[model samples]
Target: MAPLRPFLARVEAKTLLAVLLTAAALWTFVGLADEVAEGDTHAFDESLLLALRSPTDISDPLGSPAIETAVRDVTALGGVTVLTFVTLSVMGALAIRRHGRSALFLGVAVAGGQALSHFSKTFFDRPRPDLVPHGTEFVSTSFPSGHSMMAAVTWLTLAVMLARAEPRRRMKVYWIALAALVAVAVGVSRVYLGVHWPSDVLAGWTLGAAWALLCLLAARWLSRRGDIEPERGGP
Candidate 1:
């Protein structure tokens, strides 16, 4: 019991940090949403959106054609098709590794995020930015970018799950960093392509991250109750 004290203390500290971080993210999202509804973010969004495009030609994005193409590719990583494929693949892998419960949890988390995105977009009914020509196609309202939201949801959720399974601290850090890089890239690409306002991406990122953290907290609680696999150690 004495030897276990330090490890338990570390777990408690990490859990507390996760809770605080999740709360902060949620608060930020709510604040952004309120500001957006009040039209306070229009100037900020337009400035950032225009900065990424040529002053002479709003239709032309700044940078070489290749860079624009690359950004489009990155943006696609957040699209529904790509996100769905990646989530399915990860779930399949988890199932194969006999982590079926984890896979189910991931499926539910991703699906719930999708539903949240759909409902929020419908409720807000915000229009996409028209300051510049859209560089890519969009099929939904753009208050909170669906692509950016799903990018964070899928990538971060996967990262948290994978990190839990990894024994090495460095590997855990690597996974989280990589996931964050992907999510940020996707959000930036949305803004760069003129498909979404900067506030839209910001809101998407915050809300998505908050949702992912909530799922993580739930998973930890479930694990503690022996409702899910312990993975590397008991929660």
Candidate 2:
């Protein structure tokens, strides 16, 4: 009798599926961003960005004062200070746990994403949105919102790592979903704040998600091959 083949559980299958879906999204957004950079998507991008604001008052955001305050607080979650602290803290924990490979991967993935964000801004030289006053100041080009990209990279990267230690499939789903929620909120805040075009945030989300998936897939493969510390179990 032939030996039975190994059957992947739902979680394992979903992880592989996520890589494929994220890749497609990454390519789709790359094309859109290129269209934006070429000035082909300006009408669409501007319309979407403006739609999120008050129709009568361009300077005013659509939300009430309290909601606006909440949004600003959420947006701050994607800021450099917050993301950096979170990254360092998570990496420190991983290192202390003797998962050096995970720590290295997290550091490399985030740092590389930051470098890519900077290079992309320079390469595109796209100006910030000017149809309305910006709620937040910008120091770099606006092709891809740095806050959005780094937020996605940081949250999604952490989500993937943290999810692996989850023994239950539902918990894994929740972790990834929570990460996606934060990333989406950050991107929306950039547009709401009148700092980035819709396409810029979309590009950031897709690219950052892609980068996170790449890191996760690499880590998984390495662990299987005994090149890194395998997941020790528990969240």
Q: Which residue ranges in model 1 land beyond 4 Å of their true spot?
A: 1-11, 233-235
TM-score for candidate 2, please give it: 0.87
Evaluated against the true structure, the overall lDDT of model 1 is 0.89
Alpha-carbon deviation at 46 in model 1, angstroms = 1.0
- Count of residue pairs whose backbone atoms collide, per candidate: 0, 0
Candidate 2 C-alpha lDDT tens digits along 2-64? 333343433476466868977897887679776986799889888998898888988999989
List all candidate RMSDs to the true structure. 4.0, 4.1
- Maximum-lDDT candidate: 1
